[model samples]
Target: MPILGLKAPGPSTPAHFSLEPLIRPNILALQPYRCARDDYSAGVLLDANENAIGPALPSASAKKVKVNGHSDSNGTSGASASAEDIALETLSLLPPGTDLNRYPSPTHDELKRRIAHLRGVPDENWVFLGVGSDEVIDMLFRVLCVPGKDRVLTTPPTYGMYKVTANVNDVGVLEVPLIAEGGKFQLDEDAMDEAFTANPDLKIVFICSPGNPTGTVIPLPAIRRVLENPKFKGVVLVDEAYIDFAPSNSSAAQLINEYANVCVTQTLSKSFGLAAIRLGYLLAPPPLIQILTNTKAPYNISVPTASIAASAVSDAGMAVMAEAVSTLNANRDYLLETLPTIPSIGDILGGNDANFVLVQVLDGPKGKVCNNRAVQVYKTMAETRGVVVRYRGGEIGCEGCLRITVGTRTECEEVIKQLKDLLA
Candidate 1:
């Protein structure tokens, strides 16, 4: 029951927030599982029951690629081999360390270092990698909230995962809907404050900036108000899964040093285009980081995932990611300017900070939004037609709304064309 026992913040960070009360007691007392790699990774590397003679598959990383013109061991000319033959040969070979016999590194310091520099954190200590941000989200609930007794705050029409995860964990979720009338989709600070006051026992507050359905950002000042609220002693989770698409300075990672109670979850799934790799991380004060680290599985991140993520956040990868974000932002802008031209298009909500847009589909005559028609159009687009857009008819202020991802210029144009043809 001892709270406020953890160290506040690193010397320079303005955040002097304590973590004892915020973190679950059992978690704070937990002794982390020590994986084999924790002690050493270099030298003989024979500690973890690894194969001595190498993996079962032919080592592709060490082998030279025999040219297509060359003959195979079967004496068939490589040049004469069909495309399927080439694919089979490649499959027969395997990349070095791709074998499943060995365990992955438990502590991915290098990957953390890469993320630290990219996120402008003090060092790797500020970061913790998850299988995906989903894992991190779950870890937060497990580590911070009591199963049936605790609660967390979430903005409605936001990411569904927060509510889903809360429900799975049997935690109560307080709904504070965002301001939806304007395109802002910003946090209703007063309402949230009232909720916080009403629910002081809440353990976490999930805010998806550049929100999922909304595709709009919650401003820093609004976030700061929550973080600075002395009455709300729990963690303020800023899910910046779309931060890269927003303006550079709009990230809450900058506030980590300033607010110890704040935790930011970021992922390579979106802007980095590495969703398949499933690498997401959290940046927070060391105390909370240690809590999650202790609670997480020893080798939650696989070696292949780490390798792919390392390459993705590398200098070259960052350049390519920036370019992709640039293109997507342009496409998003194009959708914003073009979606309204269609007679069926009503309000294109949100600040358009993320890679997607939320468009309201209006019916004829009085221009009223019709959820039934929106659902029909969504089904038609996805099932019958080749095009696909999400129907967010059930969410708050999203009735008759379609969540459209900003695709390539041609693809966007095709969507517009199809909507025009279909709506006509």
Candidate 2:
């Protein structure tokens, strides 16, 4: 029987596959990032221009002392560092095995194993480890979106990276603002449906639960609605970076096996307390994993990052972190209940589920009051009371709002004290 006319043998037949058409034509023609050599054999290496005989980058110990205020040599601080300070400190440390002059592992296998075991996801389903969750978000746009031709949908007052990545990739962003009625924000299904209808070619839908800025979790039923829509054939990226902070468990990892179109991205930066390690993960179907791997830069994760991240995911580490998260949640609750008592604060976004809460400042007679006032308050609190919070406004709908990450119990009490003084 001719193969064209006959039904192929099921499972037993020899499989033949070609990736020529599946890859984007543009991506196939693009040149990837070229760094150091891939091989580590005993030989003089000088291909990539580097100071072969120079002093190495600053040690982690040195960097830690400069950045972290604590007396510990490991750079771990008793108090929280500002995000910018943390980023600067992390950049000071060189990649692992720098003195050995050998190339690190191309795939970060050990890290993957630890992550897989910790997350309960099979190793095969993850791909494209990057410096942060932002990198993965960028990669998702690069792999799935056609830029200008395709679009992605996100609810505003969410993580700004989804929009920023879309803009950087030259992809169109279709935003549907979440409903902030009755002093609580939730996913607006009607707006989502309308946006999807308007943009049929949307290749990705970015949903951050216990959403950024808003700190609202998209309801499970609402998520199911989006996934079940036949019109949504493209990938649905659910960013669970802050999910560990939420009261409820994450839906992204749990729904992965059920929905082929769903892909969940997470980060160690948030809950794992390994923000300096620059590790994030994606949980998707094997096919999507293959596509992401094919498109991602080779050796995207460095050895030190992989090593520390894997260590951070241990059972004991997770237990300690869980306690920390609980403490933060309690702190968040304290702030939520207490902030409203002071005047000038309007509707709050996110409720019990988030690690942070969004406080909307009511504008006075001055034309569209400045939200930076909250930042000013934050700065004063940081300097006087040693408490720091994020100011997130200046977006379309986030006017006069401040994003406050929950701190330790004592730190939170200090914050409350400072805010009370400011309000008074």
Tens digit of per-residue lDDT, candidate 1, span 12-102 = 3324345776677788778766888766867877888877765454433323343333335453325798755544344333243355567
Tens-digit lDDT track of model 2 for 159-242: 877878888889888878778665356777887777767776677888888777777777777787787775565667888888
In model 1, the Cα lDDT at residue 151 comes to: 94
Top TM-score model = 1
Question: Who wins the lDDT comparison?
Answer: 1
The worst-scoring run of ten residues by lDDT in candidate 2 lies at 5-14
In angstroms, give how far residue 361 of model 2 lies from its true place. Answer: 3.3
Segments of candidate 1 deviating more than 4 angstroms: 1-17, 40-46, 50-100
Q: Which ten residues in a row have the lowest lDDT in candidate 1?
A: 59-68
257: Cα error in model 1, Å: 1.3
